[model samples]
Target: MRKILLALLVSTIGFSQNKPFAKGADVGWLPQMEATGYKFYDTDGKEKDCLQLLKDRGMNSIRLRVWVNPNNDKASGHCSKEETIIMALRAQKMGFRIMIDFHYSDSWADPAKQFKPKAWSNHSFPELLNDVYNHTFDVINALKVAGVTPEWVQIGNEIPGGMLWPDGSTNHWDQLGQLLNKGYDAVKAVDKNIKVIVHVDEGNNNAKFRTFFDNATRQKVRYDVIGLSYYPFWIKKDYTEVIADLEFNLNDMVKRYGKEVMIVEIGGEDDKVENTYQLLATAIKAVKNVPNNKGLGVFYWEPQGARSWSHYNLSAWQADGKPSPALDAFKE
Candidate 1:
């Protein structure tokens, strides 16, 4: 009886860890869009909850980005800790698994720019490390207090070059690795089961991932998953031209690093519904094809962030407030 109980416990734990393929959307702009009185609708022209609409389209998870401290701008700002917790709780209440993306900056943090949050601007390298740990722990802990724990927490957003700039940039890979590990430690401190992801943009470019992750491995940066952003619209290549490259890169990363992978961000032109539909399908297929189910999932970046409000052409939302057919790919 004792041995049988032990085996049952092990199987239960493994089952909990092996979640279903995460069909998701990064709706970081959602609360702000709703605050600005944006309305979402279904194909039948009935008003609908955006979250519910996304669920209706078969999204099982939701991604929210958190900024350190942001202005209340609709398009450009406001993913503060308070807002993120509220959104996470709401999504969780709706049965959506949550993934929290930490931008670490007051505003945007990505390949082009990763400026430090205003409060951390003058901190020394050591102080910056503590800042990363504290800030990450604080937000995640608050979510825990609010009865919403994320399934995944990304240390930094799209940091191919690196994040927190200067000291934590690729120019200082050693420091960046330390910073990433600090964030990783903090998340585990809050909840060990929460997988930590290190994100970078340009998922199709194998060289970029190799160089960055090679540095990460050399520095012993601790993380559970590799996160990628694949935007064919931004790359100015059709998904067809670069998708095989993405598949190859996905397999390579899994083989090289012995880590799971996820396409954490992807989108196509909202107007090109059919093309975007195909893009979504192919992107999902590429990730699903990763051997041994190492490809965790694919997430459309801001599908509910309509182009009319965001001025971003890549949302899977139509001008009429209904989701485009592109999002229907998730249903499969």
Candidate 2:
């Protein structure tokens, strides 16, 4: 009886109902005039044009990054809070769902640098928690005021090292959990339906993903998502490793943790991004083949952001509007 019970429990834990691979785009590097070589906010604010183009190309959702106070237009800090709402508003009007990514500060928020927004630059850990609440509320509120509610909101980008730094660092997931929950609660408070994502850098670490989520849940922090970043460089050339790691993480999250997984961010070098994309798409199919649809979806990172600051500012797109082999990696 114990053997039968264990088998049933394990099977129940390992399989889940089919989940759709929600098609998406993180327009973090959405083309500004400068980002597109056009020179001004002309192309920058032409969100309608941008979204229309993306939708025309098969994109159904758009994610925009919010920087608290970026130094220049070339940076995402270029995205003003107002601009984000406006973009969100426009994206919805045009039929595309939207996601707002809070970098927490004015510059780019990633695994490397999740500096606190300048406004919170002087606050202590406790005070900083309040700031996270207020900041998250303020942004979500603004979008509401604009008559544009986002479908999802990521509290911070690539928060593996922790966010708002000095205080919310990984060394203290306790503090980090409390702080992140503040943002999570702020989001839920506004639109209880809005999905919340706690992102980390690599998607291949099956064990790491489990530890992170298990830790968060144990702390009583309820989040709606598990977002991951998967760059080939970070995983190395062994496509088999990438496939194996992704499958393990996706299944483990759903079957073991009951958490839906999303490849919130992913890309390879310009030259290999195409090949990387194909392999990734194939991997998705492989996951779906597992008794049940545990694999959720993936979002290509900044494919349209162009090659401006590329490791050398080279072009990242193909001659055609479609994704290069790399971006094509997710092709259905």
Alpha-carbon lDDT, every model? 0.94, 0.70
Task: Please write out the lDDT profile of model 2 over residues 1-332, one tens digit for every residue.
Answer: 99999999888776543334566677655545334553211123333354555555456777888877666656444777877776787778888778888888878778778777777799888898888888899999889878988877898888867788878887888898998899999999899988898888777787777777777777777788778777656656555557777767766777776666677776655666556656657655644654444455666666665554433222235333333445444445
Lowest-scoring 10 consecutive residues by lDDT in candidate 2? 38-47
Best by lDDT: 1
lDDT of 1 by residue, 176-284 (tens): 9999999999999999999999998999999999999999999999999999999988878999999999999999999999999999999999989999999999999
Candidate 1 has a TM-score of 0.96
Candidate RMSDs in Å, in order, are 2.1, 6.7
